[model samples]
Target: MISELIANAVVHGSAGLDEPIFLWFEGSSECLRIEVRDSSAEPPTVRPVEPEDESGRGLWLINELALTWGHGPRDDGPGKRVWVSIAPAHMGLL
Candidate 1:
């Protein structure tokens, strides 16, 4: 899940191909959160689309499957962080 989102941000969010993208993951007993950072300050426009359309839709899937998701300013960068949180399966008992 994190891989897909990070890749999408790299491919779509950066102002240029050379711009850097960052990925972060944190986990807790009840949930897992993933953040993808890019050099663009604009928030990503994630929307639903037909599965066969074949041009967009990654973020839509992320929002659907994750428990909660959003974006915010980076701690010390000019860009923003797009994030998603998912409830840990099996209640983290495993």
Candidate 2:
């Protein structure tokens, strides 16, 4: 999940924005939290796709598959950061 979001942030989020993209990951016994910050004020929006569309399903899949996900302004920039958290499927697995 973290990898996917971060990749999306780098490929799509920062496109033409020339902004720094930062990734933070933290985990506890219960869950993992991942955040990706990019230099774009505009947030990532999940839009509808056509039937024959061959791409554009990254963030959409994340939103649908993640336990919870959101995007907001970064603390030190004009861009935004996207965050997602998912509960551990098994205790002490990692």
Candidate 3:
């Protein structure tokens, strides 16, 4: 889950930017939120994937694993944040 979110930030959001990706975590044993922020203004999207495609499944995987997921423009900079929420059990923390 962390890899997918970071990869999305690097592949889809950090296209030629000098800024580093910002990672954040919040919540408790019941639930946790992971946020990946990158220096691109473009939003992330989940497009249709075919059976033979080798990629384009990161967001799909995130959707399947996360309790909830979303992305939006950064509140403090010229970038965006893609985030996911998941149960602690999924993280083996419970």
Candidate 4:
């Protein structure tokens, strides 16, 4: 989930090679939350899949695997933070 979010930030966000990407992970025995921060104000959205499409399935995969997911403005600076939370039932696989 975290990897997908980071890839989305790199591919879709305005993150440059020199820019830093921040990752946050918070979890207990029950649930886990993952956040990826990049230097783009544009929010991430799930793109519609086409029948012959060879790519663009990251968000869709996240939607299927995560209990919940979303994005919002960065707290410290410009850009957006995309996040996902996994429910307790799925934590054991981590």
TM-score of every candidate relative to the true structure: 0.82, 0.79, 0.87, 0.88
Clash count, predicted structure 2: 0
Q: Alpha-carbon error at 42 in model 3, in Å?
A: 1.0
User: Across residues 32-80, which tens digit of lDDT does each residue of candidate 2 receive?
Assistant: 8889988777788887878789877777777777778899998987778
Strongest candidate by lDDT: 3
Local distance difference test, each candidate: 0.80, 0.79, 0.88, 0.86
lDDT of 4 by residue, 1-94 (tens): 7778878888888567888889999998778899998999988878899989998889999988898899999998989899999986764564
Q: Which ten residues in a row have the lowest lDDT in candidate 2?
A: 85-94
Model 3 residue 56 lDDT score: 97
* Over 4 Å off, model 4: 90-94
Error of 4 at 93 (Å): 5.1
How many collisions per candidate?
0, 0, 0, 0
For TM-score, the strongest prediction is 4
List, residue by residue over 1-94, the lDDT tens digit for candidate 3. 8999998888888858677999999988689899999989898888889999999999988878788999998997888989999997875666
Q: Which stretches of candidate 1 lie over 4 Å from their true place?
A: 90-94
